[model samples]
Target: MEQNPPKSIASIKEKLKKSREREEECATNLQLLRQDLIKARTAAIDVVMAHQKAVVKLDEELEENAKDLKNVHVHFLSEREALLSSFVGSLLRKEKATGKTPPQPDAPRFVAPLHTPTILCFLRTHLGKPGMLYCGRKVLECEDFMLKTNRERMELLFAQHRCFGCFLPLSVAGHLKLSDCPHPRYCAICDSKDHHQILCAARRVYQGVIPE
Candidate 1:
């Protein structure tokens, strides 16, 4: 019985040692799992920050691109106005030199019905200071209704382009038509919803340099 008691005690001590080793193994595994979890969280934070930085850079590039496009449009309109004014002036001078009455200019028609009318015609027919009878009323008065109809048509065209004012893509603020303002329109700089570009302060600054 004494010998049997020692053997039983030895068996118990061996089991206890094995149990302690298992507990230590479990604790080491738990520590490794915690370390992995912390690394995952840190990596996720870094990814998010990198994504945000990329988005900011993209936005800045888009804004710069829009500004460049606006400048190009401005320059093109100025050149177009100068060319037209020169052509018209030359025609008038030639007629006066020949001692012949200058025939009234007619607005040139467009080949595509969907396109905006020639700028010269819109200026002569819709914005002329002198009154000429057309369909019982003055030409300008008669063309007012036509201009409004054309304005609606131009909305879709404007939608395809960016806004000159905010240098962003054009939004629901109804597409501003070139006919709504004077020649070489400065609609991009004007903020007034009620007034045309002719009344804009920015427009006035460049008044005489560009033809009307």
Candidate 2:
């Protein structure tokens, strides 16, 4: 076999130099990649911190708004009570001065074309409460008998287009007399469209219809 050419010192030295240069370049690239990774990590941490801060601020604002709404509602109730008291007091004084009975304001009138069985059920459920059936009735009275009697009477009144609360005849109308009420029915005592259970306790107390 032919002998291989003797290895040259120059070529070997050149190969060694190229390998060393490649190693240096790889090391430099790795260092640059590590720096970029550290920067990305820092940026992610900052974003998370900012998001947490925003959430905390939003919660605080919501809490403050809720407190404001509660305060406003309480203020409104106080004002409404004061106005009602003033109106009642003025009416009483006017009656005393004139020495004539004040004309009772006509109850709100509405035309309820539909029979509300739900209202009857509600009245039966919440018996003996003010502005509800059995308000003045004794518990000893037969519950079934009373409900049966009232149910028949109410059905008759509904057919006759009469007010459920006062049994007064109602004027034919397509809508509620009270602007706030959605139902086409009215309660003189409760002055609400929801139910005409019995005489309203609040009205009785305010108008001096019942002794405090």
Candidate 3:
């Protein structure tokens, strides 16, 4: 309490310099850590973007593959139908009574496949050959409604029996004094198994009941 020690300026200056050096070092370390954190965040973003791009590419490839598969399926079905149609056409050609030979497949330009049904005429009957089915005859004459069939389809004609009365010719449906006579009922003409010959105009003419 009685005596005071002399202070040294050199020692105090040395302590101040050491404290400043420590604070600078801490600042540098913080800056390095911030840069590292930024680099890590950028890397993570790049990885996520890359993953998204790969997923999009895979989805596009899968879609293309699915379309290819569908096309293959359609082609397979088309080929199958063509094969069956060809088989049916071959059988019908063998049924022809003509001495003339069938047109060879390798002959020339194949209009359609060999097995496609067409309407081929042997004689007066236009029923044979390949073509569309006829449900009933109509009096209206048109190119579209005509029997534009092919020869291989002849077998399909007369496949089932219709009433003999209803089976009259198309032109006759309008000209004749006919009505749709129901089967198995008391009709004066179709009383027997054979065609109802009783409705013959000649019979009425002979009996003097009506004009011939």
Best by lDDT: 2
Candidate 3 per-residue lDDT over residues 23-92, each given as its tens digit: 8998999999999999999999999999999999999999999767755654454345446556655554
Count of residue pairs whose backbone atoms collide, per candidate: 0, 1, 21
In candidate 3 the C-alpha lDDT for residue 85 amounts to 51
Model 2 residue 96 lDDT score:
82
**lDDT, candidates in the order shown:** 0.48, 0.50, 0.42
Could you tell me every candidate's TM-score relative to the true structure?
0.48, 0.43, 0.43
Error of 1 at 131 (Å): 28
Worst 10 residues of 2 by lDDT: 203-212
Q: After superposition, how far is residue 77 of candidate 1 from its true place, in Å?
A: 2.1
Q: Would you give me the overall lDDT of model 1?
A: 0.48
User: Distance (Å) between predicted and true CA of 167, model 3?
Assistant: 29
User: Which wins on TM-score, candidate 1 or candidate 2?
Assistant: 1
lDDT of 2 by residue, 40-82 (tens): 9999999999999999999999999976775565445434544
**Which candidate number maximizes TM-score?**
1
Q: Rank the candidates by lDDT, best first.
A: 2, 1, 3
Q: Candidate 1, residues 1-212: lDDT per residue as tens digits?
A: 66999999999999999999999999999999999999999999999999999999999999999777765655555455446545656776798899999665485421222222232222223344568423444322333323232223234224345332321233543555433433232233323343233222323234343222
Order of candidates by TM-score, top first?
Answer: 1, 2, 3
